[model samples]
Target: MRDRGPLFGETVLFTGTPKSPEVFNLVKQYGGTPISLPLIQVAEIEEADDERKMNECSHFDWLIFTSQSAVEAFRAKMLRFGFSADLIHSKIAAVGTKTAAALEKIGFNVSFIPTVFSADTFVKQFQPETNRQLNVLFLRGNLAGSLIKEELPFHVVEWTVYKTEKQLSSIGKILNILDEATSVNILFASPSAVHIFAEAIAASRGWEGFTICAIGHVTEQALIEAGAPRVDVKPETYTLIDLVNALARRKEGL
Candidate 1:
């Protein structure tokens, strides 16, 4: 929180989902003016994806959750299907502490939780030695790429439990930031949010002056691939608090 005091009175534009409010608070603690307008909306996958969720979820030896939205989407869909104990298997693995906390909130005893918050780290540390082909269930969103399957060697059964829809804020808000802030720092948590912004305004419209602060390695890569400007700073710890700290550090080099 005390990294050279460079973030005093800076504006930080948060681009994460609605589940993120602590990020705004963290920005304030780091002495940055936080502006949060969700650029992506999370919703349960309708129709065919629901059927796929029910079909693939029942037989997995390990159920892996990558995000809190995935956790909520899977739980809500199970409740709708009248699933008592059939929703998840006895074994569960969460990608990070936040995701594990989301599962704990719903009373699911998480058998495995990763120390690091990255999918690459989770795949490195948590893959158990299996002599036979292990069936793994990946509960994720429409925008979540096939990273899990590429990282895990087990037989994967993926379910698109949720969908992230892109949204461009009213031009008034964008203009207000342009008028009010000295420098705009757009914060990105997920690659989906980056892609959403690219689809709407990032690549196709005017965003030449905003500084991008990505949460982690994957997100930084996503921001680059989406044709967004080069990231001004990226947190090594890959958390919102650390990202805010990194934003403060960005001022040191200016």
Candidate 2:
């Protein structure tokens, strides 16, 4: 007989792409069944003029990346335009550990990460070395808000490098999971995914009969506003590794 893991028999569904394959494997290591139901799709916005505008990236004093999606889009554009990391001399600020890791993976050193992994906090905590008027470029998706650009005292420029759209195809798969599994854990990584789930599934069926786990406060608030009965789990730190560890601890009653 095999030893039972902490998450024995628990069905874990990911509403967003797992940061890495390790996240999915972690659930299985704990004896849980991992399922993927990405509720949002992100793709780079390929504008013909962007090839010219991308040159502006080298002029900014600071380059900000708020999400892994933004990093991915920026990377794709850089590769498309034949731009190298050495060409962009701007200091990089990443909002979360994952974003920073993604930036670092591409040979760019990250200069800043806020005390918390939230944009609201990033706006409050990020300060450059000098008080001079600095040019900051924020690379983001279409669904992103203007909080950083509006709140930052620096001269900010926004480049919409990516767009996020609802992944409707996952709706049927999620419903199928609900039908087959007696109890399942649904992990929400972004508020966008939460909103999609609310509109497509929760609106018709209601937010019940599943364990809800949110990655950050923003995502949790989205679930609250969507009228979920409750959010069953959330990590203290807004990272996928922490979120999964938190779920395991919850299952272990720690």
Candidate 3:
């Protein structure tokens, strides 16, 4: 595959939900083998208490959405509670373009969106002094990072809209791919993905021969903390397209 180009014959293993097809196609287009090993399974919380928590979401000052799953979960809960889209009077802040687009699709205009997508950068860019005592309501998954809540100086309400768990059954598929491929590039999108990948690798006696690539600093840190060595940490970018483009550029340079 190196005969075709830098990444012509490389196999890239993707973990997490198959949310973005664009990134997968781009890897294949560059002559790289794209493998999917979905480690985190996402499902809506259907408990009565979960329904009750979403009902009180309208009382906050701002509704912050971090992922597309959070937006979808919030929308489903709103619909179940018989609340219209306008029931949320609080302004909306989305972390990335995808989350903002999801809110817009549901008839809500995102008031604030950070140029950088990570929680740390979002907090740095947030002007809490200007909007002092802002009561921000965060809609997120069960395994979400506490960076936003810990850093914000104002009141922050965290509403758990979804949950992520590791799928051990996916270990077989990942091991099969690793056994067949000449070289593999593990692409980690989140800290949870990093943890799950590490668990899977440990179960399969490690992917020591493969190259591990993390989307951002948080994921890279997770990989290191999990005892994975030589991780390729990328610059901060919200989209997987940027990650793939950066990989292509690196391959060209090599």
Candidate 4:
């Protein structure tokens, strides 16, 4: 099974924020020496600033959740203020199955989940009505994609519930590991992670023996734009598990 795992004995680094430990364990389960150097930190936005907008959630016809982070962050902050969870009575649209599952865990019914996981695909499937205007309340992070807002002619009211910040605590040590690792496979969960990791290792030739794995086209584009010459792993499903499995398949080929 370890041989089938394909990433056996490989040193793979994870840059998934707020969920790094779980991902680290997954890498090990697949027989890789998992490294966790968090490149991003997920934090809830100021409650005082977002409170009014969050309380006004009942005005929308559609409640959109783009990521699990947004769902978690919103619940944590809003529940602390004794905010009613019943504000989400509108039809719900989740970008991916994970997000839909997260919403379901919170006891919200998911009305739609796109076949494809990207924002572009989700946007394409949604048909906007000019006559019967719809108000969509988008709960998202600071670095969220604007394709939903750009493509749909809905009255979109977005609340930035969370943010991603750089978590580069020990850059020198991380760089050393990057240089010394025999066959490094860096996994990026978001565009910010790819951008930060790429910038931090730009001057070092440490990436010569490394493989860059991006979760989606957005993150893959970030890696390419940051000059990552070899983005060897990109999954079509665009989930963390899918990304890891794709890496396993790539290693099997090698």
Candidate 5:
């Protein structure tokens, strides 16, 4: 990395899973002190018809994945049931680069990614190549919104591959940071995490000197609703790596 990078003197408090060391490494790569305090946890949902759905994968024209967690959960389920990617004939659509990368790693090709990485933009930009009616399957978590199914112009079916749960065990440490740190950069990746943080930390600590960073418009809106006076850093691209780069740029005032 660059010596004394843009984020040289910053302390970044990550609110996502610590299982993703890449994100924490990114902060350190940019010369920032990274702190891991997961605000949410993701777990696979064991549905009764999971085997049947896996068997019928080829029936859908498109498979949509909104988060990397969904991709990982799907991959795990596929492995547990001895299913292979060869069984899938449908084109894949991912909401973000990381999700697409995860799908690619699992031997599937991503056919579409929205200009912006949010579902609202995805619905507006995604369209079928032919006039024929298309069948789509969205693999998502329990907390995923209904915007995709409600807005897509095609026949859409949803499969809950995962569930996002609040992780408030680290609230004490988060409170300690807020109380002791002179200044901190708090990064939020999802709306669910924002809500948890709002309840556990923000309700008491408030947003005083913390530099609130959001991954995308959705999370940014959540932060705004959670009483973040202003979002200090938000990348045009909505990904964790881009979020770190944006934070570095902000530190350097570029």
Candidate 6:
């Protein structure tokens, strides 16, 4: 049976490589056509200096993972370095449900998760008992914010688990798709994606006709800072479903 719904006539393009099937399917379930154009390719650093960072994992009081990518990258590095899961004696905290689940899958029970998912929320929810001083090790990508360190009173150690680089070939394909698109609703998931997308567009001339939809405030600011016109901004939830649903709601209003 043919379904007629809110997104029945809408076509959407998704950027970034989807790490999960749930998110991938969510895009299709909504009546919109889905296009996957990964603008960034994540690569693990295997240098001796980078490996030394993982050796110091046992020194922290808490190991915080901000994204599933971080968790995966950290795990792979740990295995490569001959470090066992037991090396992670510090209590683990994850920034979001997906990250928490990733940690759990590898037998590390997450000790804390913020009610809201953001660097600010994560730092706010962190409480240090009077008897205990905390030294937190944050695992993230190269483009991650330093806001967590700025906001926290505890001693913080940051490790860049993975590095994201612009995939120029993918960007070229994205540009081609944008050129052929009638009305492109470009969704930005992170501030990094926003920056990378802007850089890609600028390098490819410009996305003058496409409507830009940022996933959150940070991304909105990034878009504006990059000289792109803003079309919409999603809330703090930062889920693909939320963005898709919000897009559907806007279409209904129109």
lDDT of each: 0.77, 0.90, 0.79, 0.79, 0.89, 0.74
Model 5, residue 41: displacement in angstroms?
Answer: 0.1
lDDT of 1 by residue, 35-130 (tens): 876677788776755755575565778888999999999778767776644355657889877788888887677888767788888888876766
Q: Which stretches of candidate 1 lie over 4 Å from their true place?
A: 1-5, 48-58, 82-87, 170-172, 204-208, 252-254
Candidate 5 runs further than 4 Å off: 1-3
Which candidate, 2 or 3, would have the higher TM-score against the true structure?
2
Model 5, 1-254: lDDT tens per residue? 34688777778998987546787898887888999888999999988888988988889999999899999899989998998788789999999888888899999999999989999999999986887999999998999999999999899999999999988787898888877886689999899989999998888778877899999999999999888898998999998888988888888775
For candidate 5, the 10 contiguous residues with the lowest summed lDDT are 1-10
Tens digit of lDDT per residue, candidate 6, span 46-131?
66775677767778888989888898898888778787777768889898777898999887989898876777778888785657
In candidate 3, which residue ranges exceed 4 Å CA deviation?
1-6, 49-52, 128-132
- Residue-by-residue lDDT tens digits, candidate 3, 20-102: 68888999888888878878888776776865676677778788898888988888887887777677688889988888988
Error of 5 at 199 (Å): 0.9
Cα RMSD for candidate 3? 2.4
lDDT string for model 4 (130-150, tens) is: 479899988889998788787
Predicted structure 3: lDDT:
0.79
- Clash count, predicted structure 6: 0
TM-score of each: 0.83, 0.96, 0.89, 0.90, 0.95, 0.87
Question: What is the overall TM-score of model 5 with all chains considered together?
Answer: 0.95
Candidate 2 lDDT over 145-171, as tens digits, reads: 899999999999999999988889999
**By lDDT, who's the top model here?**
2
254, model 4: CA deviation in Å?
Answer: 1.3
